[model samples]
Target chain A: MKIRESSALILPPYFFLTVFFILPVLIILILSFTHNRDWSQGITLKNYLLILDPLYLKVLIRSLIFAVLATLGSLLIGLPMAYYISFSNPKRKILLTLLVLVPFWTNFLVRIFAWFTILGRQGLINSFLLWSGIINEPLQLLHTSGAVVLGLVYGEIPFMILPIIAAMDRMDISLLEAATNLGANRFMVFKKLVLPLASPGIIAGSIFVFIPALGSFVVPDILGGRDSFMIGNTIKNQFMTVRDWSFGSSLSIILMVLVLLGVSAYLRQGRDQSMTLGEYL
Target chain B: MSHRDATSNVGFGQGKSVSIVTISGLVFLYLPIFILIVYSFNDSRFSASWNGFSFKWYKIMWHDGPLWTAIKNTLIIATANTLVSTFLGTLAALALSRHRYRFMGVYHKILHMPIVIPDVVQAVSLLMLFAFFHFTLGLVSVILAHASFSISFVALVVMAKLSNLDRRLEEAAMDLGANRFQVLTQVILPNIWPGILAGGLLAFTLSIDDFVITFFTSGVGSTTLPLKIYSMIKFGITPEINAISTVLVLFSTLAVSSIHLFDREKK
Candidate 1:
């Protein structure tokens, strides 16, 4: 009887998700195999072959480099930020955590756009430099590949910080005390105990930063110049401008596969096999 | 051990160096937004050098008819999306936590599928689906795209709330001879009401701020505020865009502060 009632409750989401998410994903997958939406011509490997071409391949490789750099930068910066909070007084911890989270709650595009003032040719750094006699000409800060990486790291730091903080909060404080008492020095305790214990969070944080950075287009499009085009731009161009739906679908499938790999790794690392929103906040 | 000595011995907090790094990280996160807000009021149009403060940009934004239309469309989409997603998402949370069903694990995976994939890919897929069905590109399509993505988020928040919920209240209500439905509606639902609200608020925020998915699914003449902001960008950096961003940041701060207050009051 309880099952009967519960099934009724479950039916809406199942139906809703089926029509909107699952079916759309299936359509795209099927669409990828067609010859530029001319399915009557039968399935072909043309789209996949197009993606493998060197001109497109450069974009894929460039995106990977940017993502990897952004992930590493986030980890380097976010680790210390998380450690400070995890080890702080209870009252201060809440305030500190909120400082990290405030940026996250705002508009993502606005955050990227915020950098425009600081990185534009006539922007902050350039104006300051000129006034101080540091440079005769305005330095080109915006519209560069480095600016894209900066936007990504800045955007993704909250994701990296919160998870590591959660992990550190969950850690056994006594283990660190025991190690110190057993003649392990400060460095040894961090290396042997705190760092190892925080490894799961580090992995989770890396996955969080890497996946979005990998698929990003807005930051690149806004901050980067023409040469800095990523795979996302390529896909968007194909679907919207070129109207090559088959090629775009194939690209989407590849990106989907890469993201799924990250999700599988996250699931494997997390003992609960799920990430809850409460923990993120 | 003294508090200072204990922290130092643990070696995680090297005190000054760690403090500096943490402060710098916070500054890096905040500095851009701060500059953006300040620049919103700058009188000069071209030079990055500030002239003086003015309300010119805000005034310009006020008279922009298209901006008003976008705001109307955005509010409608976000409000409706929140209602539908929160309802479906709360049911999903209840289903996962309270009841046993066949293929529950598979259903759990299905719920998370939207969240794990890239938004750009999700947008492309939905665009294809809508195009295949000859569905008109407009407000309705945008709502579907946003809701499909926002549902998992709502479900996750409510599930977190459920995990921390006490089941004995429901059992005691039943012991007092209340029907099962009464136990649920009276006991379980009331206890998790804050969680439901939190989920709703989150869904609303996601729908409002979403860009990538909305970019694809939205038809011509249909625009959200984020879409409006992007269109503003193509014309170059203006004080008007900064003004809009400042407003968005302030609004989000207000929303987030209320959530914290509500959560604290509940406790």
Candidate 2:
């Protein structure tokens, strides 16, 4: 009786998602294979094959590289912060976490724009360098790969930190105490106890950061120079600038497939191994 | 439990470690915001110097008509999206909670696709769909796109609250001759008001801050605040941009703090 009642409530959300979201994505998959312009022109593999050119291929590889780096950077910063917050007093925890989330709450463009003012040639960093006589010329901080990475790491760290903090909060303090009592030193305790407990959060955060980082167009567009084009920028340009919807759709499909495969592999490994590191990002 | 270390070391060492870690974490999280706020009032264009405080930017931004239009559009979209999504999501949550299905796992997973899939992909797909259907790119498309994701989030939050809800109360209402609709409105909703409010606020924030999806779905003459900011950045930096950002940040801060206070009071 309860089960029947529950399904009735679930039905609306399911129906909406199926019709609006699932249908569109599935249509995209089908569209990528069909004719470019006219739907009536029928099926063709040319769109899929078209994205395999070296130019598109290069963007794909670059995006992967950036995603990997971004995931690792966020993880490194987020994991330590999560660990620290985990051991903090409960009273201070929420307040401290808010600091992480406040930036996320603000308009995303505003935050990125703030970076331009800080990093642009005539911006703060350059002004400081010029004043201090550190160099005769202002350092070129803007429109660089470094800036792109910095922007991404700045943007995504909150996402990484929050999940890990949630996972860490769920951890039992007694486990760490037990490890310490069992002749495990601090380093050993962290390695054997804390790290394992934090793995799920870290893994989840990594996936979250990695997937979006790979597909982000804004950061690279604003911060990256000519040579810094990522796959997202390419896809965006194709649709918006190049007016090549078919090619863009194909590129997006490939990206989706790659991300799906990567996540599946991670999850498969997760199921195979008893991951202690899952809880902390 | 203190076998070796004396009383002096027990709490102090751990406390010190935690303090250092916490301080460092706060620095990581808050330093950027601190810088942003500090620069907001600077007379100098750069953040490097302690430029004299000036409100010029605020004045300029206040006068910008396009920015005002963007804000209006944003409010319209956010409010409409929040209402529709919240209503639909609450209905779905109630249905899911009160009924059982053969494909529960599959159902839940599909609903969560919007959260997991990259935003860019979703934006492109939606653009293609809407464009193909000959839908205008203005208010209608943006609301539809925003509602799609908002519903998922709202459903998830409300469903969680629903799961923890005591069904006995609803049963008692029914036993007292109340119908399903009456019990839902009078009993279930009041109990889960917090969750519903929380979800609604989230949807509002997300819709206002959405850039990529809104960018794709947004038609001509429907410029939102984020789009305005994009245009501003594309042109050049201005004090007006800072002013607008400050206002946005302030609103966000107020919203977030109120929610926190509410949660605390409940606790």
Which candidate should be chosen as best, given lDDT against the real structure?
1
lDDT, candidate 1, B1-267, per-residue tens: 134335534555546777899999888988989999998898888646689999999998899899999999999999999999999999998888888888888989899888778889999999988999999999999999999988888888898888888777776777899986887798889888888888998899889889999999999877999899998886766889989999988987776667667767967
Over B124-147, each residue of candidate 2 has an lDDT whose tens digit, in order, gives 888888877888899888998998
Local accuracy by lDDT, each model: 0.86, 0.77
The weakest ten consecutive residues by lDDT in model 2 chain B span B4-13
Candidate 2 TM-score to native: 0.90
What is the C-alpha lDDT profile of model 2 across A47-149, one tens digit per residue?
Answer: 8887678877777888888888888888877777777665555555567676677787888888777786678777767887888899889898988888888
Q: Please count the clashing residue pairs in each candidate, in the order shown.
A: 0, 34
lDDT (Cα, tens digit) per residue for candidate 1, span A1-281: 23334777789988899999999999989988999989699999889889889999999899989999999999989998888888886557778877877788899999999998888888889989999999999998888889999999988888899889888877777787888789987677777887888877888888889999999988898888888888888899999899999999999899889889877877776657344545673
The candidate maximizing TM-score is: 1
Give model 1's share of reference contacts: 0.62
DockQ of each candidate relative to the true complex: 0.57, 0.42
